[model samples]
Target: MPQPVPPSWKDLGKSASDLLQKDYPIHGTSLEVKTLTPSNVTFKVAGTRDSKSNVIAGDIEGKYVDFKNGLTVTQAWTTTNLLRTQVELENQIAKGLKLDLATTLNPEKSTKAAILTAIYKQPSLHTRATVDLFKGPTFTADAVVGHDGFLVGAEASYDVQAGSITRYAGAVGFSAPEYAVTLHGLNLSTFSASYYHKVSKDVEAGAKAIYDTKSTTRGVALEVGAKAYLDNAAFVKAKINNAGVLVLGYTQALRPGVKAAFGLALDTTKLNDSAASTAAHKVGASFTFNS
Candidate 1:
């Protein structure tokens, strides 16, 4: 069997912030209230509901920073049948090194799990190593090196108790003002390449191809997508894949702190069988209020 390729910086997809700003319905109705003071103290409360599942959740969190000691503390609570608490402490050990310690506790069960992480940074390279001291020990480490427009990264994970390496991946990529490309691999047998280009000031296009070396049939898939920015704080994106699946989404900001989005997905192959099963769609709206 082929050893898994370690993860590198190249595997990261669109970030949550990007998706949220694009009005993706990944999160249903969300409301957040936050307060910050001059002394680096902060408090926040957020609530969300899943329109499809009708599940609701809320979180309350607070943070305090001691700049003189280079330390910060954060605590959070999640509302549920049994309340869960999480606490984290971060300290800067030196100019370019930091440590993070965190734990999650379930009061009802009196059970807890801890995590420790160390991060180091330099002008051209960054590294992070983390350990989970839970039921079974696990370790993960990754590093990235970059200069100018080119970058490369590698990542690996091990199961300490099992005494074996479990995960590995890597990526190499470059970005220019007008174009970007990345090659990523997993477990030696699976690989993918992606390319993106700025077609114009308001439009962008991208494509991706994936291959599995071990597969006898259906070993490859391809997808292409594009985005267009319209006037007045609105944008649209569309994508299609070799499997005859298409997705289209549109987002618009009505005013400050208010946004709405709609998305539609269609399987052309399913259309050939039945029209009712061919299309799926979702609509979402969000509002934020700050004091």
Candidate 2:
């Protein structure tokens, strides 16, 4: 088989943007302010001003670390119906074992949610498990184990009111220094597979295929993306999916503690069908400052 060609800097940027959007969707305009102290403490405040919706949302967070005991604590507040507070703690139990706990509280309503997670690692194996008891009587549990480049994971959620398992998922994956592949099945009906390869030191590419067996369409959606580094400080990326959606993004570092980014998405399929209907375009910009 022929080897895949390395992506260009532009492709690399687009791939990064695509993955980032999966975890953190871009709203209108946003600003983030962060500060770090010599004592290993940090503070952050971030907000989004969406002129389109005439709304503003923001959060403030503080974190402290105790290097001696391998312990870390984080507290955050967000604008909720009645300002919500959340706290997370992580501590090393032993050389290869760690524990993590987090909780969110609604002071006005006297409601709270909590989760606990544990991780253990050895020279050849790593494992993590988490339990979430957030809503009144429902709960969720998930666990994953990895060894020798191979991984297996499972997750299940229960509804106390219904007295049954509401959701479940399982995944398997294999990873190497130059390539990785993963397959996931959710609720026994939805399945997704992903493949990634490092074409070169400065470039990489990936693809994902998804199908829902229970759906009427029964068609698989394929997404392909690539990313490349222009240099140490800047890059561009692009991705296109079976749905005919295209995304492009770029990022550059202006200087220490300052960075800028821009992204755009277009409906290529609409443009192909009719020039007049090609109105699905979005653009976003963000700036970050650190001290």
Estimate, for each residue in 157-255, the C-alpha lDDT of model 1 and write its tens digit.
899999998889887877666877777788787898888888888988788888998878755888888888997688888877898877777877777
Candidate 1 Cα outliers beyond 4 Å, as residue runs:
1-22, 26-42, 64-72, 81-91, 108-111, 213-217, 271-281, 289-291
Q: Can you list the residue pairs that collide in candidate 2? A: 10-236, 11-226, 11-227, 12-227, 12-228, 13-236, 13-237, 14-237, 14-238
The Cα local distance difference test for each model comes to 0.70, 0.69
Across residues 1-291, which tens digit of lDDT does each residue of candidate 2 receive? Answer: 322222221122233335434322234677788999999989999988764575888888888888777778888888763343333333454676677777787787787877776766554444555667665355666555556666666778788777889889888777677877778888999998878888998887888888999879789988888777899988777778888888887778889888777777778867655554535656667778998
Question: How well does candidate 2 match the true structure in TM-score terms?
Answer: 0.81
Best by TM-score: 2
TM-score of each: 0.76, 0.81
Looking at model 2, residue 57 earns an lDDT score of 89
Model 2 alpha-carbon drift over 4 Å, by segment: 1-26, 81-92, 108-111, 134-139, 159-163, 272-279
